[model samples]
Target: MNLPKRNSEDGRYYLMTPDAREKLQPLFDRCIRDAIDGKITRPDSLYPPVVVSSEGAPFGVHYLAMDWAEAQRAETFNVEQAVAFSENLRRLSRWGEIDHYLLGVLERELQKKYFVVTGREDDHRWNREYSLKPGIRAEDVPEPLLRFACYVAVSYKVYGLDFQYLDTNYLLGLVEKVRPNMVKKLKENGTGRLPLNLQKRKKEHFTASANDAFAVIRISAKDCTEECYSEVLNYLCELLSQEDFPRSYAVEFKGPEKKYLSITGLPKKGINQLCACAVQYPSLQSLLERYARLAMRQYERYTNLDDEQCALPGSFAVFALGMLGQPWRQLVWDYLGLCDDEHSRLQEKFLREYVKQFGFTADTVPIFVRGVLSMQSMKYSKDYAAWMANAESLGALLDAKARLSEIVPSGFSSDDDDEDDEPTDETEAGPEEVLQYAWETVCYVIWGKASAKRGLKVVETAPEELKERYRQIFE
Candidate 1:
């Protein structure tokens, strides 16, 4: 089987076979569409830079895959940090207890050869990745070694590179699915009234972030001795012995006689850059849950517990894993399983954030959502090609925007508004600007350029609510 080989000239990697792209692009296309429609539990779990897009995409929908060139550099472990952590342990004579798997990883590092280790306890996605360093030719590696890499690379591809993307075409469709409850949420937030649910989510986000940041083990600097270091190492080993830990965790040693030791794990963000993986992706959540629990037991040992007393719960279910936005994901799956539905209901919280950003009046919000959705989901490929290529399509779009402006109100007054402060002609004119923003966003989302210029008219803008353009899919 042909695999990706490094180009001797430019010093970059390329997938060898053309047929592979042909075979796998369609599969990713299906998965991406399903994910956006709320079918997939962990939309963020799909490996290989899976993205959302529309129109020019290969599959007849808004989902596509794009090659992630930056992934290799980002995925490379921090060698300096890893080495210092190891050397400190060895100096303290705690290296013998370093487990076999980590030892292998360390050995490969010392030899100056490349080794990519998959994080343990994965979920719906095959997130295992590889790095083909500069100066390493394809011929140097065995065919069997890269076959799986080739398969995964192909499975989520669109065309040559663009393995995954941010498909804004369907965002309109997604926005159209919002419930009335969500509309009320938008108005509530506009009035500076925080919902109970958001208050809870805010607390959860804070706690999860604080805990992950505080994942450091501390011992007094005065107690600095080989025995103290070994004691800490033994605690870590015992913590790791339990299944409760992120599969990608590593222990980083601090300076000589330092008061603390940090167990650095994979950045909770994982492959989906915007959201943290510990709260969204199942496998990572399971591992972090394990890590947190294991570390807790170790902490208990430092105070009152003995070795046997510090054992973890044998069968802890990682429903929420103590991270923000995870329990709702579990509920989504429970909903799907019990109802046997193809897609879970649109998340009210998600829509709440949506309208919170746009601030559409309850009356006009649905209309605005429908207009954008129609523009995105509309299948006029020949027309879209013309639009991207020239000015007529954009002109028509702007005209449509003008027409939509007349009908759609920009915003609504809260109950606190005085009778004298009620909307007037100037207030009615607000939809013109709002709809102008909407169409500009539509142009940007569809075109992907910083600005869409046609003749002298130019539309340049950004997206909110979906700006990270990256979102987590609920299970």
Candidate 2:
């Protein structure tokens, strides 16, 4: 199938149905009509916010106001925070017990200073009815505040923080005390009148963003003991270790040693940047579902073409993994059993298909290397290309190749090889060369050179022979 056209304005490639707007137009119209007619007491939270276009027909749809805040936050904590967090943890020797005190301190820091963690109050989608109204309306409630409230409530309930701060009745009572005229004015307006700023709007498609709330742990000026510090650090790590998705956020600690500790959900910033440039990522749950729909469609198309092979090309799956990144990468890998040793059937099948597709012989190592090198000549920016060509990455590829050789025989040559075939020098080098070339390309395409360096570092420390081989490659 042909690739989608690049959006001239943003240079993004998008796939949309031919009549997507026409199909959605009536639905948008009905939502506004019902809300105005009071047929529906509130707008449906399920639908994206709808505003009438000044030009008519094509009404503009802004994101779910809440998503704006999330995108902003996701782009904030970043990799530097995670690095700092990790470095600080390395300094502690004597760890203490993680009790209520540490959890309470972190909870208070997160909840009490909500404005700092989340954005300003004005940052939320402002609906007079939802923000000022006396009763609960799911659609009317600003998403950030609701989410914050949920976080605070959950922290108090689960972690046993002072629940008084989040008590619904106490909150309402404060509102009554402070803004007595608010509800009266809302009542006078009858059907909720939107603010002037929200009258007319424009809409854009959703891109997944990393809107995560991070916890920053800091030591007070008091002469903090090492035991107390270790206790706090351990507790934070424990909290960070819970689950992958919703619970996955950055954790930063500022200790007396002047070092910082951080743990974030995604990989480093450089890797994410490279992946972002190469492929569309699905950071948001909604976007993931949309991408899954597209993948399923592709799967069906390939299934019709051939049933003997795996559902998709393993190379294509590798490309998808790079695009997905982080938590999504692990999630996709788990779904495909890419990391499962017990399910080696798929991996072995992929290897056979790979050998056949490329027609690789034991003597074709140089050809494979050249193929990968030629691909690097594409019109990526000079900086991007430089990242892929760096020495550290070459070493990493060498290490990856060496390690993979242990699992798949180093003598693997072609799909037709028999058990009786002798392991010649050429055969021994073939599989390693294939892995080196493929992984080098994958790393270059997905994560650029920095991640490749990190990958080599893993092989350097984790295995003795690979480390020596890695040193030799770079030597």
TM-score list, all predictions:
0.16, 0.23
Give stretches of model 2 more than 4 Å off.
1-216, 221-226, 241-255, 259-399, 402-475
Alpha-carbon lDDT of model 2: 0.29
Tell me the alpha-carbon RMSD of every candidate.
26.0, 23.3
Model 1 lowest lDDT segment of ten: 204-213
> Cα lDDT of all candidates, in order?
0.28, 0.29
Let me know the TM-score candidate 2 reaches against the reference structure: 0.23
The residue pairs found clashing in candidate 2 are: 61-203, 74-210, 84-260, 84-261, 85-261, 85-262, 86-262
